[model samples]
Structures are given as structure tokens and as C-alpha cells.
Target chain A: MIENMTEIAISQLLSETQKMKYEDYRFVTASCVSLGDDGCDVIYHFDKDLEMKHLKLRVGKGEELPSVSKIYFCALLVENEMKELFGINITDIAVDYGGHMLLSDEELESPMAKQQITIVEKKGAK
Target chain B: MSKTVIPFGPQHPVLPEPLHLKLVMQDEIIVDAIPAIGYVHRGLEKLTETKEFTQNTFVVERVCGICSCMHALAYCQGIESLMNIEIPDRAKYLRVLWAELHRIHSHLLWLGLLADAFGFESLFMQVWRNREKVMDIMEETAGSRVIISVNTVGGTRRDISKEMLTKISVIVDEIKEDLKQVEAAFFNDYTVKHRLVGVGVLTKEDAYALGTAGPMARASGIKQDLRMTGYSAYGELDFEPIIEQDGDSYARTVVRLKEVYQSINLIKQCIAKMPEGEIVVPVKGNPNGEVVSRVEQPRGEVLYYLRANGSKTLDRLRIRTPTFANIPALLHMLPGSQLADVPVLILTIDPCISCTER
Candidate 1:
């Protein structure tokens, strides 16, 4: 509902996020919403002087998305979270965890993914 | 010099919440710090998919025990926006009252934890002892000590009577008096000053770049606060964001300590200006849109993003907790610091792993 929310291409996410930084907009947070089998929507929220701007990106499975951590270091945490929990492949993270940050062995990994059980069961069998 | 890797947490005496930091140190100085969380992750955000809009209020409240009321308020505000409901004036005032109370209690809890971190056990006991008064106020009004589940979709679930308001005012006065002593001890005590005065310095530029929130940013002279957005009854209240230019551990301490007094004043203003009206309005229809709600919690800015599809359960619920935002700031501050001062630096941000991992 926020007027400043703008949808951008997956390729433009890094550039747009860098532009927000140059415009003095603080990187607030990032979120990922599953769009079923069509892939997921990654929403990046930014703010300056209480005014907010959201940049959304749509990416499908096997698609590699650029990381924004180079522009905003704080993005690393959320990016790693998205990679681990949502199974999004965020490439070139400034501080790459290589898929080991929040999730552990006892937990259900990538529960937000559409084929969560299949992925986990496959990994478990190994 | 040889390098050593020290795992700071996941089980530490000073940390009440579980947060693991892998500190790469060169002798006594930290070279790099890598943080690992999710020990307390309950996947509460995912729970919103199965819970109804009304029931999800409670689910969000449980996201963090310290700032439960703010979580509920943010969730309710998002849902209220979705349903296009204008909450009653009295409900807004009541929400602010409970929110300020939560702030006071949360800061007090953090101050106590900081004291314990520095081995000031007696100070920690005294701070928690005074914190009990705020807990009593919450229990008396909201019927719960920590997770005061008074927030609903259209309005609040509970209301305070006129007599109860007077009693709360009296208790707040006593709390203000008690906080003065705690403030003096924190600000003037030699040990606290020596340990915290110049430690963990995050300059204004670094703070802005790192996107630190609440007292962490305010302490660094950013002057950023979500309360300035005037959500709930905050627009009607008269108060200023407590700012400190030092950007050190002591500055962060001073900001929180002074904000305790500010919260007390805000609560008083809410009590005096509270309008007489219905507390709860009947909410109709399921939400079918998206909304972003930001609230200033005791720790910092808590953001909630909600999306619904004309159904009882929400489609996606994302909570961007303050501690989650502050972790990067912590990572920035850890390097170039002595190993022993790590606890103080960690506590300076008032990191809430429960909220971060939720």
C-alpha cells in the first residue's frame, strides 16, 4: 500500500539497492515471499527520514540473483537467511556462509521452499 | 602474532539470549567476527500462514517477550490498515500507554543485563528490583506480566478503568524516582564509566551506513526513530527523541537510561489526554491486501510486512526485528576491540536474539 514501492527486475536489484544507498536511504530489511512454483518475490525495504521505499524482485528456481551486501553490509544477514531458509541462490555475498548460518541439522531446512519435504528427504537420505 | 578463533556464545553467562559469534582474534584484539543465530528460531512468521488474522495477533506477540506489546500493535496496525478500520481514540491512547510501559520495562531489563555483564551483580539486582514495579503495572492493567496480549485487529482487547489509571500514575511516579538512582549509578559510577565510556564506538557515518536503529543510531547522532512517524497516539504526545553524540557504549547506555524517563512522561501524557470512547470496535471481513507496519520498540525499529488473500490465514508474514537490523552494527563494532570488552560491546546494542531469530 505504500506509494513508493517499486517493482524492479531481478537483474536491477543490486543497482537499485545501490542507488538507494547513494540517495541516503537506509537499508531497513529484506524479505522473500514464495510465489508457488513460479519462484519467489524478494522484497527489499529502505527508508530515509521515515519515508519508505520497497524494491521487489521476482526470480525463479535455478536463477542466480546478485547480492546487495556489497552496497549495504547489513544485507548479508538477510541474504544469507533467504539463501538458507527460502533456498534462494544469492551469489557473491560479501560474507558468504555457503548455506550455513541460521539452519542446523535438527531443523527442517528451507521450509519455505515449495518442495520442502522432497529437498529435506533427499538430503536426509545422504 | 598467532591467530585464535573464539566462539563467544550459544551458551554464555552474560547473554540471556542465544547468539553465537565466531571471533577471529589476533592476540587480545578481535580481527573479524562472524555471527551465527537461529538457536531460538521458532519460525513464528511461518506460523501466521495457518493462524487467522485475529489469532495471529497472539502469535506475533510471542515473537519477543520483551517487546510483545509492540509486536501485537504492529500486527494489529497492519491488519487494521488492510480492513480499513479506524481504531477508537481511547484505544490509541491505551496502546501508547502500554507501549511506553513496555519500553520502560525493556530498558530496565537491558540495563540489568548490562550490569550483570560487567560483573556489577548488585546493580543488576537493584535494576531488576525496580523493574518489578513496571511488571506489576502491566499485570494490573493487561493481566500479563511480559506478553500483555491486549492488542486485537480493530482495537485493543483490554481497557484500563479511571481508578486504575490513577494507580498507574502513582506507580510511574515511584518508578521515575527509582530510575533517578539507577541513572545516577550508571552515569556517575566510576566502574561503569571506565568500562563503557569509550568502548564500542560506532561513528555517525558508520551508524548510518550500517542502518542501526533506536538508541544505537540515536547514540551515534543519527536521530532516527520510528516514533517520530507518529504511529498510534504518539502523534498527539509531546516528547523528543533522546540523542547522544558520543556513539560509544556509554552513550548507548545514556540514551536508554534517559529514554526510561521519557517513556514515563509519555505514559503520563497518554493518561492525561486519553479520550473517553469505546475500546474495541467490531472488525468485519477478511483482509485481502498487503501492508507494512513499523513500530519503535524498546530495542529499536520493528517492521512487519503482511500480505493476505481474502482468507482467514495470511499469505506471508515477515517481521524485521530490531536486533536483526542491529547485528550488522555489532559486527562492525567488534573488530579492533579487546577480547574482554566483547561482552560490553554486545550488550551495548541490547541484542535480542529471540526477536532476531523469530
Candidate 2:
């Protein structure tokens, strides 16, 4: 399990990210864990001199979260992926792929957060 | 001057993977380069949640064929931490041994690609020809060449016999000897220097700010390597993070070239100090916690985020591969670069689309 994780409000996302950037912490990557009916928990991982630090933010379902790409331009890719795959609406990504970065728009929206679709086989032919 | 936009990839002679860049050119100079990815996306992260925790080990290995062992190693290490299971010392040494061998072959593969980017076909053939010896060593020892599934939850699934270890040691020495023959062409040749040196420069400030990892960061004089975190036998190993300060394509090339040598030395050290004991331990329960693991792959640091519940299936698995993190730096370097140097510049980052899009 991870250590040194500090939970913060979603409003503090950009400012906290800016703080890490000011402190010279390398933005490792962010992961969004969908809580289903409970929205999502977004975690931002960072490292300074190989010491790991993490920030966790809890957001409501379908919430348009703020993008940290302004503070750290490198976060654009993950933010866009989160937008496309998790159905999390992130506002102002440095490079927004409009939900088509890692996936095409026609494939499936928020494929990770969506409920499982079971396929029913046609029995007449057999 | 007229502005012309050129699409650089998704198909190119030098590209090893499908990475497209929309290069905005003003005459012969590139003004902006917009990267277009997802061409190889398989939605593997989303797929991980459906599979049981144990089965996901095999799934993660398929993310990228070249660094499959490292992927397994990181996944297993994270699971072991969640379960509080301590792998045997012999298992730890064996992990390091196989990992360094992967590094040797991976760097060699990059070297060949770099040579090919500059149209040095003979050099490319020679480098890959030497690389086959490493593949042979892995096949002989692990019974699989590319995606060697040697790692498991508690420890390793296989063990190397003493005779095989001796053979690996001899083969690696020969690899070191063979690399020297192509060293001059890469390091001192006029065409290579002309194409690589001073092109796509990333200063130390830009590298850190852009959050680049592995060789992209290290080559620009950042002393950040996840190996220094020492998850496995890296703590006991004797090595330093190779750094080059020039912040140019040549500097990046030199950094990886030196790393190939360093990996050879580390492999030799592992062979000499490998302890004999049980390679695995039994596990009793599913991992029921959240964990993040980092491993230094040949390209750079790869981060894994895993969330498991009390059941067999995992809640989520997120992989922030090194190539994904390096794309911003690549875009940053693209501007103010020559149009002809785009492919060579892309190769310098050693982009792996499978790993990035996974």
C-alpha cells in the first residue's frame, strides 16, 4: 500500500499542484479510481529527490474537475485520458483530445467507469 | 515564408512504433509538432479490472513485449508489499539479474534503431546481431526470449541453474566486447554527430519542468532514477545513475550507451553474488489494499497503481509508463528543430507506443 498520501478537497487541486511545482517535485502521474455511485477519487503522485508524495481528491460523479496542466504541462496526457476513459469532465486541459486520445469517440465513452454489458447469444442458428 | 504542415509518422521508415506527429513547418524549420496517439490503444487498464489479481500479472506483461519481465517484477513487488510477504534473497537477486539482462537487450535495440534513424544500416544490423546473443542467453536461462514470465506474486516462478548462470556471465562479457566494435561509429562518426548533436536540445530546466523520466530526464543532467529507490537487489548493487549534461540528442545517446555498459556490469555482479535458496514462497490471501510501485525500465521509470479488494478481481490498475511521460518533452523539443531531424529526434526519446497506449 502507498504511504505519504494526503487527502485534499477538489478545489485545492490546482493550487496544491502549483505548490508541488514550485517545490520542484516531479509530477509522476495521476490515477482516477471510479467509486461508481460515489463518484471518483483522483490521486496525484509526485517525487522530489526520489521521495514519493501523493495528493488525493474526491470528486462527485460527472463533476468537471480542474486540470493541473496549467501548472504542469506534462499532466495533459493523463488528464485527457481521464476525460475520455473515465467520463470525468476535466476543464481546460492543456491539450484536450475531446475524449479521443487513447480511444476513438465512437468506441465507448468512459469505458472504464461504465457498467458491464453482457452479450446475449442468438440460439436459432445453432 | 510560407507555412506548411507535415505529418511525420503513423508510418515511417525510422519509426519502430506507430507515433504520429503533425509537424507545422516554416520552410525547413518546425514551428510546432502536435502528437497524435491512441493508434495502438488496447484499453488494457480498463481490462485489468475484469481479470482476477493473479491473472493480471500475465495481462500486464502483454502491455509491451520488450520490458515484460520488468512489468511482472513491479506488479509482483506491489502485490508482495500489500500482502506483507517477503520474497527470498535468492529471488531478489534473480529478479535483478533478469532485469539487467532486459536492460542490456533493450538498450541495444535502441542503439540499433538510432543507427537506423540515421540510415546507418550496417551499424543497425551489427548492433541487433550482438543483441541476439542476449536473447539467446535469456532463452537458454528462462526458456522464453521476449516476454519471460519469470516473476510471480510472492517471488519468482523459475530459477536459473548454476551452469546457466556461468553461461550468461560468459555471454555478457562477449556482448560487452561486441558493443565496442560499433562504439566509434555511434560516438565519433561525422554523420551521426551532424544529425544528432545540438538537435532537439532539452535543457535541465525544461526537462524537470516538463516532467520527463528516465533517459529523457537523466540525459539532461537530472540525477533522478527509480533504481536509486532500491525496490529489489538494486540496494545491494554497485552502480550510479548515468548522467549527461549536454541536453542534446548526442548526450541522450551517450547516456543510454553508457547505461548498456552499466547494465552489463550489474548483470555480472548479480551472477557473482547470487545466493542459493528458495525462489518462491506460498501465498494465502488476495491483496486487499491500494499500492503503487515503481521500477526503472531500460527506457526510464515505469509507475504502476493498483487497487485491490478482498475478492479475486482488482478494483483498478493504472500504468504511467515512461514513454507517456516523455511525450511532453518530445513536443517541447520538436519546435525549433529541423524538419529532416524529426525522426531522429523521436528515436532519441525511444518512444514505445504499446507501453504508452496500454
Q: If scored against the real structure, what TM-score would every candidate get?
A: 0.97, 0.96
User: Model 2's DockQ?
Assistant: 0.65
Candidate 1 Cα deviation (angstroms), residue A112: 1.2
True contacts kept of 1: 0.74
Task: Show model 2 residue runs off by greater than 4 Å.
Answer: A115-126
Worst 10 residues of 1 chain B by lDDT: B176-185
DockQ of each: 0.76, 0.65
Candidate with top lDDT is 1
**For this target, which candidate reaches the highest DockQ against the unseen true structure?**
1
